[model samples]
Target: MDETENGNLSSDYIAWTIVANVLAKQMNMAGPSAAYNGQAPLSEAQMKRIHDYFFGRLHGGFQIAELAATLGMSRTSFFKRFGRTARVTPNQYLQILRVEKAKILLRNENLTLIEIAFACGYADQSHLARFFKRYVRMSPGRYRSKMREEDVA
Candidate 1:
């Protein structure tokens, strides 16, 4: 291979190797010694616990206060820690999660907007429409219509 081609191949191999290492570490398939040692160390176990707690339970009627208590932290402290770890406030994160689920329901077309709203944890269709507009920049109905048009195209 030419010098440029050889360099590109080497770079691609290095990138793939790093990705594989990270995946292995995340799955805990690699031995303890294979874990990443990086700057600004925090407990990976603690972070994993937090991630599971937030994502797994939050959608099923788990309240913020209860989450904070589960983490053995005051509500304020928990909010700060959750924000620091997640890079968004807890409520913002929950809203995003709920909205994403709502988008899936919108795609189904069989569910009424009110049903989808309730399924995704909103109080009603109006509440869903408000937050959906804020993040998605369109009403759910309009968004679904656009998706249908795109599918036909």
Candidate 2:
């Protein structure tokens, strides 16, 4: 709740914000009808193209600026559009993608952590470890050991 400095309740700001966001989402789902009333949202095909372009180059150190250029949008615009369509920003999507790929690579004992890091588009083992801790809640070595245990079972 939002209120004056004196502390009496003035507005349910959080509830209204949630309602506004939900209504905006519903309007976005309404598509062309909503577009005719306001600005046209990206079409399904446009969104697919964006996803395809991003995934196709995901392994080659793709940048938000590069993706924005491919979509003919500014960085902020592309970030908003991609977030609305994918429910995650480009960097989040890329990190998740890389982490998923790293999981698969982890099964290969022949690869070192540094090698896996490079393969997964991370700068180094430390970079991979940081994201693993953030996303997977464990270090890469721990994740690999857990996978190993699961496999043996």
Candidate 3:
């Protein structure tokens, strides 16, 4: 009922929506033959480890080569395996992850653009603005304003 409560509920909804959509996409890709391929599919543990490593690098700053080493894989082999499992190149996946984090931060409206940029692993607000425009089709300020307007309505 209060503003804070409403904001928390909206944030929860947004997070759940993102997770649901991702799960739906994965579910749609599941197939009998896809599981029975000659090469063993990644175990759930392996998938979780890979996902955690990738997500951590995006959410928390970590060098790509270091992450690869932590996974006990060479950079080339790690990238190849990650791409095969995630269906996107490592760089592309990182970009998407960063953009998604930026979207969540945009909704907060308390943090300055520069703060959000660095929090999302961008070099600066300008860097974030460029990628935000490329991926979201609008500047971060505009995106936040629009979302607030929609919330008001």
- CA lDDT scores, all candidates in order: 0.73, 0.78, 0.78
Q: 114, model 2: CA deviation in Å?
A: 0.6
- Give a tens-digit lDDT track for model 1, residues 1-153: 234744687777789999999998887864444113222222566567655665674346567788767756566666665665677776777777788888888888788999998888888899999999988999999998998888889
TM-score of each: 0.59, 0.62, 0.60
lDDT at 118, model 1: 83
Worst 10 residues of 2 by lDDT: 32-41
Model 1 alpha-carbon drift over 4 Å, by segment: 1-62
Model 1 is weakest, by summed lDDT over 10 consecutive residues, at 33-42
- Candidate 2 lDDT, 1-153, residue by residue in tens: 456786555456666788999999997887766333323466798778776765676567677787778767777766766676677777787788788888899999899999999888888999999987888999899989998999999
In the predicted model 3, the residue pairs found to clash are none
Number of backbone collisions per candidate: 0, 0, 0
